[model samples]
Each structure stands twice: as C-alpha cells, then as structure tokens.
Target: MEQLKQALTSAPVLILPDPERNYVIEADASDQAVGAVLMQDQGNGLQPIAYLSKKLHGAELNYPIHDKEALAIIIAFKTWRCYLEGRKTTVYTDHCSLKYLKTQPSLSRWQVRWIDFLETHFHYDIVYKPGHKNKADALSRPAHVAAIQIEGMNPLLKGLFTHGYTIDPEIPLAEKRHLLQWDNDIAYRKGSMKIWVPNYPPLRQLLLEEYHDVLYAGHFGSNKTLTGIAKHYFWPHLAKDVQKFVTSCDTCQRMKSSKQKKAGLLQPLPVPEQPWQVVSLDFITGLPPTTSGHDAILVVIDKFSKMGHFIPTHTTAHTEETAQLFVR
Candidate 1:
C-alpha cells in the first residue's frame, strides 16, 4: 500500500514503447541535410529506435549567406512535418534570430506562410545549438551546391522541382512599338525647324518685351530662365502654371548634377576655454581704389564663431593710422 502511494505521489514521465520512439530532428545550412533520431522505450530498457538522414530537395542559391538563418528554420520545419507524423518533436538549429519568432513585427510572405503552417501542424519546440555541436545538420550544406549544378543541367527536372512557375510569350513588332510610344513625351529635332510664336496677347508681350531683360539680368541657365518667367509672367496670369511647366522641363533635368561637399573638421579655438578670446586678421589686397581713396579692406573674424568685421583702409596708411582704425 505504501509502495502504491509512493508511486502515485511521484512525478509522472510518459515513456514510449521503444527508446527509439522519441523524435529528435536537426537542420543545418551546409546541404539542407535533415537528420532524425526516433527513440522508443521497451519495458526491458530504452532501445535503439530508428535513425535517418536525407538531403532536402531544392538547389542552394549562390548567395546563401544572407538567407542561411531563414533556410535553417524552413528545413527544420519541413523535416518535422514530413517524418514526425503526430509525434511530439524537438528541432535544433543554430540561428539565434528564430528566438524572437513570436515578437517579430514583419516577415516576408514566405516566412508568414511558414509560420502559419508551423503553428497549425505541429506542437514542438525549437532549440538553438552552436554550429560546432550540430554536425549532422552541417553535412547537408554541400548537397545544396551539388543540387544547383544538377538542376542547371536538366530542364525537365528543374521545372518539376522549382518553387514557382514561369510563362513566356511573343508579341508583334507593331504592337510592341505602339506600347513603347504610349507614354513618351520627349521632343527631338534634327534639322532647322520653324519656331511658332503664340498669338496670345500676354504670351506675345512676355516674349517680345520681358524675355531678353530677364535672360540678361542674371545667368541664362534654363532653371534661372524658367524661374524668371514664373516670377514675372506665369505666376500672375495662370493658376498653378509654374508647377506644370517646371515639372516638364527636360533642360533642368539634364543640366543639374548633384554635388556633395565634405564638411570641414572642427578645430579647437586657440584660447580654448574663453568665448570670443581669439581672432584671425587678414587684408583684401589689390582692391580697386574706393572714392575715399582706400585700396584694401582689413578683415578680422572671431575664431570661435567666424563672425567678421571689415574696415576700409588705404594701402599707404601708416601704422599709427591703422592703429587708430583698429581702435575705432
């Protein structure tokens, strides 16, 4: 009676018929090698159940480095689904990323489907193992490379094993040309072409009276020309006219190039701790003589903030006069 009570009170562990009945699966990157060990417990003792390993279907991508962690999760799930058959299982992988599976905010469509399938079909736990300890899974990596070569040689087998479908068709030349021309707006000129001057009063007045002055007032680049036209003529007469014309300007698009200048490194001020304590002095030499007979400007800048002070002075000014200018 005491023995029965002791057995009843003790924690229970459900044991399988043969030691080989327990499912252990491993997935690795090398060759998509999936390994399984099934254990069963006999009344006599735990017995060697069944051990199986196989190269998975599919060629390895040439750049498998980025997708290694994703592939590991997929192969691990596939092996469990294929062989475990209603049995609880443990899957081991080396990818740490899978540890946050439940909390990941975004996943690719393929990953979403994989997760859904895993949640629906299996009750299992994913365990992380270091790469060196996961030897059976490591063996699968080489198979991926060989599979790729084999698929490349055989088109029929390739089609049969490929993950997605493809279609190819031909279109008539005339139809292709029409499709190519559908959205094209660019103008082309080969020889001399007649320029049409608009008969509208405002546009004519703008071209005849204002265009030359605006072009000559500053640089005649297309952007500046367009801006001048917009400010003086287009903005006053038409609603949203500047936006429409600017959007279609091919000259601006072709002429503009992006320029990035490196920033100057910050140097500590000579009088490091005090503000406005240090200054730089220089002269603007060879300046045209001013009406006051000054030929150059003395420039001084605060080293800390680079704020400038310019003072007009003559080249012939004596040191005493320069000192007076500085004092003033």
Candidate 2:
C-alpha cells in the first residue's frame, strides 16, 4: 500500500485531457459542500484530469443528501463544460439513488433542470460507487465553511432590498428561521433562495416590471409572470399585483391578440310583405363581352318569396338604361 502511494505521488498529479479517450467522474457531497474529480485512463487505470469543488450557499446548504449529490454532478459538468460537452463520460456517485436519476419517475424543479442540462449537452452514465472508495469524499468534506451572505446581484437592485427592509414593517427582522440577514440584505427561506420583498410599493413594482414588463421577459401573462417573480422574491398579495400589472400593461394589450372574437351586428332586416317589396341587388361583372356589347349580369333577389332574376347588361351601362330595363 505504501509502495502504491509512493508510485502515485511521485508521478504527475493532474493530467491534460485527451480527446481520443473517455472520462470518468467521481462525485460526492457532504452537508455543506459538493466535490468532483475528473479522470481518464491514458495507459494506467484512471489518472486525475481535473478537480472541482463548490461551497454551498443559501438554501443549497439545506438540501437533502440525494439533491446535494445531484448538484455536485451538475456543478462539475458546468465547471468543465468545455472538457465534457462532446465526450462519453461515466459518473461515479456515493448516493445509490443517483444511478437511477435519469429514470426517476418524479423530480423536483431543480432536479428537472439539472437533468435537462446533463441530458442535453453530454452523453453520460451514472454508476454507484461506495463513499469510502470515492476520492471526492475528502474534497466534499471541507474543514471550514465561509459565510457568503449574497452574491452576483445587480447593485441598484440590492440597494432596493436594503431600503425596503429598513422602512417596510411587514417583514420582521432576521429573528425567524425563514428570514435571514446577509450583510446588506434580508432574505426569505423557501426551498432555494428567495429574497423577502418589503411592503414598499416602489420596490415591489420594480420587481414586477423586471419579471413581466422587461423585453427579455416577453410580457408573459399573469400566471407565468407571477411564477417567475415568486421563485426569487416574496411580498404580500404578489399574485394579485402581478395580475393587475400584466392586465394594465399597455404594450401587452397592443401587441397581443384578443382571444374573444369581434361581435357581429344582430339587427335583422324587415320581412318583406311582397316578393318585390324588399329586393337585394348585386352585379357580377368580368364576363367576355358579347357582339351586342353586353358583358355583365345584374342579379336581383326578392327577400320574402326567395325569387331571383338575372339580367344581362354592359360592363359600363348607363344608370338610366338599367333603370329603364328594371321598370320595363
């Protein structure tokens, strides 16, 4: 065993990926972190190609074991997408349930997303590897965990959360488990990370506009807009506010087609007492002109009796001539 360690350590630690060879990944997740090791067999059995580790933040730290395990694989793939995009990769996981991840009958919202990305970009297989045998186990169990309150947020928007939390009394201080204070901002705990929106109307309105009224958001209807915003923000009557905002969106009203059709006029014509009392007149032109210069047909129909008459006339016949024909 000591000779094996000496030989392995004396050799190169990390290797460059070879395009001709396939890759193997060993992934593991602890309570607060996830890690993965990418390897390939040049001539010796599975040598290390790269290593990836991510510290969990926000609601990620509270995910179940299987979800954490799944997230580890997703982060590994994302981190080394260029290395794995068009390769045949085999993944080893300590979580046995992950072997059936692709075939699982049901999945969470995030799971579906993770699976979608994996299935779309890479050709891969999941295999069950025991925790003790997995090298990633060490990397997954980091000794110290740092506190990252918030990350990768727009500066102007982050300021809004701070301002609203100060003045808006609807949300309590970070006393409750569901609510948290991360440096300059307060957040709500819903499964993943959701920021607690205050009662301030301007802040709430800005959120609604970003999720619904923005050009990239595509002016989605109330339900979709509500779902999108609710995923990352919280406020009282959020659904109702989204409904009202979408309904009043002038651009949506102008661009979107109404589902209801235009109403037709319902007034009925007066029933004729006599055959010729109420007659309808129409002209069907565009015929070949005859030797007598006649090239059109005048169609007359009586409303009450449903009687009809067809009289031939010139395409440009005088009104007096047609009137004289009708009188005769």
Candidate 3:
C-alpha cells in the first residue's frame, strides 16, 4: 500500500490530447478533495492526458457528496476546456445522480448555477460507473485507504426539515423507512431537526406567511414561492397548493400585475351598416370647471359615417341625465 501511494504521488508523464480524437474524463470526489483524469482514446487503450485534484474549501466543503462528485466533473471540464469544448467528450463519474443532474428537482442555488454553467460550457455526455471501476477515485484519496469515509450523516439535510413533509410513496420501502419516522399520528423525517407536518390549515398558512410575506421572500411570484417553500417542505400536490395560495394573496393582487403578456391583438369593431346605426360613446373627464358647471365633454361617434357629436355636461352628470341629453 505504501509503495502504491508512493507511485501514485510520484510525478509521471502525460500525453498531449489530439484535437481530432475523441476524449474521455474520469472524475471522483472524496470528502476533502476532488480529482479527475483527462484521457484520450488510443487505438489500443486509454492514454492519460492530464490529472487534476484540489482540496475542497469554503462553501465547497459544505457540499453534499453528489455535488462534490459533480464539482469534480466541472473542474475537470474547465481544466481541459481546450481539448473537450469542441469535440465530443464522455465524462465518467462514480456518482449516478450526475447522469440526471440537469433534471433533478429541488436544486439548491449553487446547484442550479452549476448546472447552468455545465450546460452552457460543455458539449458532453455523462456516464455513470461503479466506484470500484472509476479510475479517478484513487487520485482523490490516499492509496492506503480502501474505502472513502463519508464525512457526516445527513449532509444533504439542510432546509429539508424546515417544513412539514411526508415520505413520498415512490420512495423505495427501505429508503422510506430510513427517511421517515412515525410519531404519534404524524410522520417525520429525521435530520438536524424533526420534520413532521400536520395536514391542517394552520401549518400551511404559517408556511405560506413565512415564504410569501417575509421580507426576504420579496413577495416573489407563485413559481418562486413554490420553490422557496419546497426547499424545506413537502406535501402532496404542494406546488398546486402554493399556486393557489399565491394567486389568492391580496397584497400581490393590489400591488403587482403580470407583464409577461401583452394585450391581445386589437379587434376593430365591425363596420356599421349605416351612420348613427352603430355609435361609440365616451366622456372626456377632469376638464376645468366652467362657471355654468359644464366641465366635461361627452363625445358620441357614428361608426359607419366616421363622424362625431360633442356635447358639454357636468362631470358628475348621472347616467340617466346623460342619456336624456343624447335623446334630446
């Protein structure tokens, strides 16, 4: 083991990637470090082109195992961008979740940003391999260590217990039991805190108030509100419930309106068959008050003849009175 460790740490020769040839990347991450190897397909076997490994620090140190694994891929791609950007590259990772990285739900802010970066910057396919088969796994850890020691329990549990949640039925039985505990009549997921939610209205309202009315929430729109609440809570049809709640918010209705759509195309009223047969009427309000109390103009238009009639009237004129003047 000591000899192997010495050999792995020893400097070695690296091949230059051929632009016209295909490339492959093997990436892996340990609790403290991320490592990857860039390889070119030589007709006989895979030739190592480059090796990368870095210790995790700061916010990156807090990332969950899957994210660390993903970080390894991102780092590898960035380091070898010159060779992999234009050509087809296949990325191999021991973490299976990375295969569906872009489609995973309830992504953290960093995860979303990482996914965006990966999508925009790389043209590649991710392939999943067993930990034992991944070549880069050794580079990320000491050769003496036969297995990677996970840093902590519930690394992915932050914000997961902030709200009430139920174990999804789709979860496998073993995982369901592992993630949830039944106490009294309510079920809870164990993490830094217990996550249990009563299906009652009060709890739902409290969650809505915190997520939709809080200062940090900023009265975000329904989709954003749903995402914010979902980071820590789960319920059946939770998004639909959030949609309904946000849609019914009086504050949102009074202070905000959607600008995503424009008014539909103008439909001009059908041309009238004859002058005065079809008319359009409107009142020009807020004119200067005249001494005779005539401070508004009622304009009537004959749609067929393209002609108009203007009459002066009081701004407070009643509908009945206005109709009588038009009759006269």
What is the per-residue lDDT of model 3 for residues 146-185, given as tens digits with 9 covering 90 to 100? 3112223133332232322343333344245686555443
Best by TM-score: 3
Q: Identify the leading candidate in terms of lDDT.
A: 2
Error of 2 at 311 (Å): 99
| Candidate 3 global lDDT | 0.71
CA lDDT of each prediction against the hidden true structure: 0.47, 0.77, 0.71
Model 3 TM-score, all chains together: 0.43
- RMSD to truth, every model: 26.2, 18.7, 15.7
Residue range with the least summed lDDT across 10 consecutive positions in model 3: 144-153
RMSD over all Cα atoms, model 2: 18.7
lDDT, candidate 2, equals 0.77
Better of 1 and 3 by TM-score: 3
lDDT of candidate 2 over 1-328, digit per residue (tens): 7986565445586677898888899998876688999999999778988878889999996686679889999999998888888899999986767888888899999999999999899999998875557889878853321111135556776787778878876656443544554544566544333467877888888777877776667788897677556534567688888999999999989999997888898998788887789888788899999898889988888898988899999778788977876776
Question: Comparing candidate 1 with candidate 2, which one achieves the higher TM-score?
Answer: 2
- List, in order, the clash count of every candidate structure: 18, 0, 0
Clashing pairs in 2: none
